[model samples]
Target: MPANLTPQYHKAEEVYKQAKTSEEKIAALEEMLRAMPKHKGTDHLQADLKRRIAKLREEESRPKSKKAAFDPFRVEKGGAGQVLLLGAPNAGKSAIVARLTSAPTQPTPFPFATQGPIPGMMAHEDVQVQLVDLPPITPDYFPSGMLGLVKSADGALLVADLSSDLVLDDLETILAKVSEGRVRLFDPAVQTAGAPADSDEVLLVRIPALLLANKGDADGAQDRLELLRELYQGRFDPLVISAETQEGLDRLPGAVFGMLKRIRIYSKEPGKPVDRSSPFVLKEGDTVLDLAARIHRDFPEHLKQARVWGSARFEGQAVQRDYVLRDRDVVELQVDL
Candidate 1:
């Protein structure tokens, strides 16, 4: 089968050619990869693109000449997962971060108060989720490394200021800017809505997004939110919040955790009690074997049967390696000496 490349892929290729910086080139290449039709015909091309991308990333990570010294975008991901706070200028992105985490935020009435990416840990029950407050994105101005950061995040919270009548326009502008990089935002209901139902030829990064209508305490905020709901018509389930008032802020962490779609698994030694404080996080529907492999490199090859505690039919019940693990499940692996 011939590789039926789309117009979007060709556009990305053009951008890649015109890119002046390594980061810009990488972003364009990634956009190309996302836009390319995934088929056997493009498998080799995909592999080659991936190889080039890896090489570029490796080159960028290494120390270069004295002129290229600092890299501000290199954020080490921590906690359960990283969630990006994204929106147009002064959409309350900084305010939201300040309310949720201890990270110092410059939340003023002025736009573009945040000039760099700021990561903060938001506690969700026993675990912590990394939330990065990114510079506001707009059609005229998007930070060079913003796309990469958004693409690498587990999920995103698209904030809109309910106090302003331009809220809907701001939301649309943000979406358009992201889409130009081949990234699409959708809720669970419209996950597959962007692609054609009959074909698998589409290439797009469909990110799970939560619409946050901030400044809920503002005058006429309720009317704005109602209009927003009517405008989107269930496409985006907007979460009304007041970062200053702390109203609806408590539920933000839980909503972010749910968007991550990850499960927590506790591990135990032969005779020791399960360490409940720290959990080995895995994507939902992962198997016991996956947890074993994560625990140790040799566990998968030299392991025997395993016993389960939480989410098991019985306490300490023996389970095979293929047993599907559940959230908060405690696993005790018995490996052969």
Candidate 2:
């Protein structure tokens, strides 16, 4: 196991080491799931463990005792980016997922029908974002732990009904629940919506938001759209879309990617792009020195200086890594190399 996985391995070992029976072994496996890293490398190991754990647990619990109706819907992380979709019932979330990714989803008319999170993905150029359509939230079934997942997502898409008054109430309920990220309506004409041009109200969290008014083909949609726009005081660009027809799905990925910030810069060494796809994603104004520290502790201390060869300060300008890097600024390090 890699050093990064050591902690989890040790945890699992400790849990299983003292287990004397199948039941205890099953409990240990559950702990491993909580601790193990979820990635390609661990896929097989995870699957085997889950199988063993399930078999053991199945034997332990008789049909009557088994409370595990089994939420077969486990949250599988997709793509490098994650965009969580939230809304009330009948918000066309499943349609959005069906149109965007190849994931198989059952689209139907019902509230809270999606018992758990459904993850799908779409690519924007070379980058891909996983969109998770979670169970619909109504005043009756607003679970606390489920809300936490939305708070940590990279971005959020809030769906609404353009033809109904129920949307307003849903919006208010959602606003009350979000602990992180700002809320902004999306524009039907545009994909990525900005804060109102006139208002100086700074978004509480710069986390991107998409306000989608679904059922564009329905009657009174335009009237509802205008009403929603006024309700938000045009702070957000409200998007009127018909997910049923897959309208505006092409722009969906772009809108998501636009909200995400990423810029590639070359490394100090020849033939090295700083691997923008590395586990650590940084923003502008972060220094190459900062990246060095993140990559490894020794690299930062041994670092001498850096040379550049991209758009930051014109080509081939040698500068110290402390010199904050701008987006697309190539950095060649003069470290132990």
Candidate 3:
């Protein structure tokens, strides 16, 4: 069973990483375990994967039915991308959501605030991304059904209260609850780990998070902020801001948008040319065939070749659908006419 073990494991892990929800991750892990070979070397690995899977399942079922049912949640469908915000109590998650998007969010100062997910639409340079604000979670808090929501996010912003000396404690507590290992930041150069085995869920969380230290305007907050960043050892790109006065708020949108690895490309159709003003935003790794598939699955199947007439070159250069497309590049599909 050593045949193709490496590649098979890799692909499964990739899928698990891309999975947006805990349910999806769990399903992927089960399959990985099934595909993996049973041997002495893999025994420990298998056991660890199974234990993690069980923990996810157990945490998913921790809350009561009434409490779970009462969780206010919304999943926004239309957007270039989506980001979920994570933080502890009074961390200004709701305020940031309200400041960035056109969502009517309630900003309160109580513990266990925002008992559910609130969806908001954020627009940037004609592109729109959805943001979700989830309920505050402490070190010991693992509310039922919240894991799935966090897993679904394209990216996550870890918010902290810089004005308070306990900001570092907050980060450690929150990270302990939701994260595992180094989260991938969608870097094209760095390859992912070995493929996943059956029953092992890959959490492809985009990391190098945008760390926000709220209450920047408060006295002595700046010094505390520096100390926190140094303590993290550049693990996070820290931004000091006051959600109330909107200080440093302008940069938050950019940070969120930048995390999205997607780029826009226009398609020059055979008969009807694609619109450049409103192009589709796709992840960086997507190839011309990927775009074709997005436009129509059959496009890739029947796609004989394609032509490019943008950034990569001048005029139109005929090419294959597998050609990797770049940001702002214009492509023309040569299909059966």
Candidate 4:
């Protein structure tokens, strides 16, 4: 049989060829692999693509040289997923981080309190999500470093200061500046496509984001928030929250976790008790093979069947390599002897 490829694959291949960064190349290659037809004719090609992907991934993860000048903006990702808190000064990004996690992001009565990126783990039940309280954005002084952070994050909270009448103006300022930096923010639930990509000087990233109307506890804040929503109707769906009084905060962690679009899986040795403490975080719709890949790069190619405790018809049911996993699922892998 002849190997068939899709237009999507061809398009992604072109993207890979023109990619200037390892991250972009990897993304394009992954898209190509997903679009390519699988058959005996494509077996060798599949293996070749896999080898190339593995090599690029290794290069991407390799530690940087110690002698190189340190970049203050670069933050190492941690926890279930990395989320960026973006907004204007005194938008309560710091307050949100302080209340959610004990990150010491001292929120003062004034603006620009958070001068740098502070990564803190916010726990919800068993899993922890990483939230980075980044420097504020303003009309004249938005941090250039923050655009890069937003592009790399899994999600973002575009916080709006409800206490200020110029909340809509702040939103416009944030959007305009970020767009100039080749980054676009959109609620995945609101819109599908984004503006066209820019030149190779920067890679354009469209991040899934939620608008947060912070400081809702303030007087006349609700009226201002209503106007803010009306002005940006269908553009951004804002979530009303009061960081100081903890109002609507009870829903925050869960909302953050939901925005991440991730699921946690627990791994177990055959005939051994399941270890639920350290769950392996995986993207939603990930399969058993993905979990195997996460465990070890070689495990995906190495042999065999897997058993599932959760998201199964019955407990401890045997599943195939491509078995789609669910949140909090327990998995046991059996390899060739």
Candidate 3, 183: how far from true, in Å? Answer: 7.9
Please write out the lDDT profile of model 4 over residues 1-337, one tens digit for every residue: 7788876667777878999888777666766676678665765676578778779967755677999766666778888888889889888898899999988789888888788899899998789988899888888887656766766677888999988878888989998998897677887667753433433322456677888889888989989988987887877778899998999999988887877778989999987899988999998877787788788878878748899998999999999876789999999998764
Query: Model 2, 259: alpha-carbon shift in Å?
Result: 2.4
Candidate 2 on 110-181: residue-level lDDT in tens?
666788888887876655679887888777776655654553456778888875777789877776666332
Write model 1 residue lDDT over 100-159, tens digit each, in one string. Answer: 899877788898888888999999988999989988888797655787777666788999
Task: Return whichever of 2 and 3 wins on lDDT.
Answer: 3
The 10-residue segment with the lowest total lDDT in model 1:
193-202
Clashes of each: 0, 9, 8, 0
TM-score against native, each model: 0.78, 0.63, 0.74, 0.87
Query: Which prediction has more favorable lDDT, 1 or 3?
Result: 1
Off by over 4 Å in 4: 1-4, 30-63, 192-203
Candidate 1: where are CA atoms >4 Å away?
A: 1-71, 189-202
Clashing pairs in 3: 9-195, 10-195, 29-199, 32-197, 32-198, 33-197, 33-198, 33-199
Q: Please give the distance, in angstroms, between residue 278's alpha carbon in candidate 1 and its true position after superposition.
A: 0.7
Cα RMSD (angstroms) for every candidate in the order listed = 6.5, 13.2, 8.4, 3.3
Model 2: lDDT to the true structure: 0.63
